[model samples]
Target: MGLFDSFSQIRNILKNIDLAAVHKLSQKVDLNKLMGTVSKMSEEDLAKMLKFMQAGSGDKRPKPEVNGDFYDLSKTLSAEEKAIQLKVREFMETEIKPIANEYWNKAHFPMHIIPLMAKLDICGLTYKGYGCAGKSSLLEGFIAMEMARIDSSISTFFGVHSGLAMGSIYLCGSEEQKQYWLPIMQRMEVIGAFGLTEPEVGSAAAGGLTTTCRKEGDEWVLNGQKKWIGNATFSDITIIWARNPEDNQVKGFIVRKDNPGFKAEKMEDKMALRTVQNALITLTDCRVSEVDRLQNANSFKDTANVLRMTRAGVAWQAVGCGRGAYELALKYTMKRKQFGRPIASFQLVQDLLVTMLGDLTAMQTMVHRLSQLQDGGDITDEHASLAKVFCTLRMRSIVDHARELFGGNGILLEYDIARFVADAEAIYSYEGTKEINSLIVGRAITGESAFV
Candidate 1:
């Protein structure tokens, strides 16, 4: 090898030494004098000394936790919030990690784990009563990130039940309705789903829901199709939104699964988020009792209230997926060897890793502030829309960069990065598409409507 290459190899070997060993060595010998003596040695001699040091120091220092929270955002959380964050992380790593890929590959939900999840007591976590935790939105966002770090589909399943479906009832349901449904759903005894996106209306759902509702004496009949209803296939209840035919205004109803007119079929053959039980729902003459209608959800604006909260959850999910991918890449680079050294020892590989970490830190800090706004009651639709748009875009980029770091193994599901790659796409499209979310912010800032 040339002299330059020899010097490079010597530097690489020295960089891998555990720093604690150097500290201990300073106590035994004068570090300054020792370094001065070493300065006269050739690269070959330096390499020999490095091997000796490494052999002695292998067990002396523990590597830091493989984390993507570059700015330590979790530390900013209160003690209770921090505890809940760790609790959820432990749960995901212990329970979900083992079966996440298996369930994803089979496109099936693990129904048996529901009880274990309920014991976590996280459903409807942000609401005040009905056995809910009444926690701040910041805690809720961190918990969402923890779950997505392990599995995005499971996070989606929880977000729909806790944020969207339950939030609708909590925000718009009558006092009786909240008392009746919130307690059971909070315990997850009754699973919930949200049905708002339709086959023809996704980004245009605000003004374009094809579903219609008509009041007939004591019952209101609903007729329409809802596509991509999360948790609906086997959920005990679903929150369906339809337009009032008389006034052209939107309304919400809590539709029980076994209602004669309610039908849900599992959507099959998905490329991403396969473990989430998304369903195609048909409400044909679906008769809902007057009492079942959300007492306060008289207009589409009520629906927007629920979406505003859930959109933040989506942004946090994107952060989790990106964080998971970046950490996986970091771990892989440390072990996978290319030229008699770990790939991570190379400078170019480290540059990529740093870039991933930078993007992840930005996304993490952004969501942290978003959650704060939500808890402080200062959040707007535009606040959530900005995060939903920017974070998901950064998340996609992080996953792409992480996948490239894995090289050929990136495509293999067994290695884990492949799952994050596929699942991030699902988070990207759900909640609100990038274009739709951008317009929400656009209209807020410029006071001009760009949405068509």
Candidate 2:
């Protein structure tokens, strides 16, 4: 080969090799002599030399596992708790991850997976009795993270059933009500939905519920609409929060799906969490018997208790969504090449990843402590609200960075980062919005009411 052509091949091989290895080789050998020797070599010899250097370029060491738990917080769980976490992780990875994009694209919930999820026996996991395992809130937080790591829609579905719906009954139901519903709901034989958000009232639901209930004889007549009611399309019962005209206090009722005046229409054309069947529910004089009333939920304070408990789970879901996107982006960078080397090796790409990991690790630690407070019975509205606000805000940034790493392909569903980006929007708004949650924390810190 000509000397110029040989030099060109040598430069190409060096570009593909690790720079550190080449620097070490330069220290041991004379570059002028090396170039002269290379100029004399045949094409077959040059190929063999290129292959040898590539093999010696430190590529033989196994790549580290791409775990999003940068801090290894899962190691803090007990052996049994870790086992349960792994079981849920396995279920999500095996059953949900494969079909996440397809179901999301079609905007249809995989009904068959409900039975499969039931087999996991995770519903009502934290409650003390009535078919529950009485697990710790920390473990429950981990479970929430695991579910959203695969698909946030499934996480939302489970959170609505186990956290909001069953939590209402567990916290506000009478002895008789709890005996009848908790076990069946925990076993997944019957599903539940939470109805609190109304057509016009969301942040002001504490005092401005348009859904009204009037008592007459043994039944309460409910008249209003509930918007963005998750799982209401197929839920057997919905925990409806309405204002009582008698005392102007919000009350909770277990309204059955078969109630004559109750109707739920599937909300369509949602850009996010499409696999979740959110419903626009209408209650035209919905008659719920007084027997189904949550006897303990006489006011909005009781409803706030349920929200306070579940908001921590929502924060955990944000962590899961961020973790999923971060891991996906990290994997993509390592495989996607730019110039010559993988994009992951680039300094700019590494900076984005480190920033994402910093935010994710901070979120993980915050929620870990939040669950500890909950388990210790010290969790407050402000505590949950802070995590909800911070984690979700960070989650949006993480998903954005993830999508940016994918460049143009980020918007494609086939790439998977697009789903995370889209789903992050829903997570940011649900359970509580940033402004509302920030005000909750603000009220707690300053001891001054911010609501007008």
In candidate 2, what are the lDDT values of residues 5-44, reduced to their tens digit? 6567557667877788778989999978987887688877
Expressed as tens digits, the lDDT of each residue in 1-452 for candidate 1 is 44566556556655776688668867999967976777777877876775675566452346567889878888888898798889899889999999999999999999988999998889999899888989989899999999999999999999999999999999999999999999999988999999999999998788888999999999999999999999999999999999987898999999999988999999999999999999999999999999999999988999999999999999999999999999999999988999898898899999999998998999998999999999999999999999989899999999999999999999999999999999999999998899989988999999999977
Candidate 2: worst-modelled 10 consecutive residues by lDDT: 53-62
Report the backbone clash tally of model 1: 0
Report the Cα RMSD per candidate.
Answer: 7.5, 7.3
Screening candidate 1 with a backbone cut-off below 3 angstroms (N, C-alpha, C), the clashing residue pairs are none
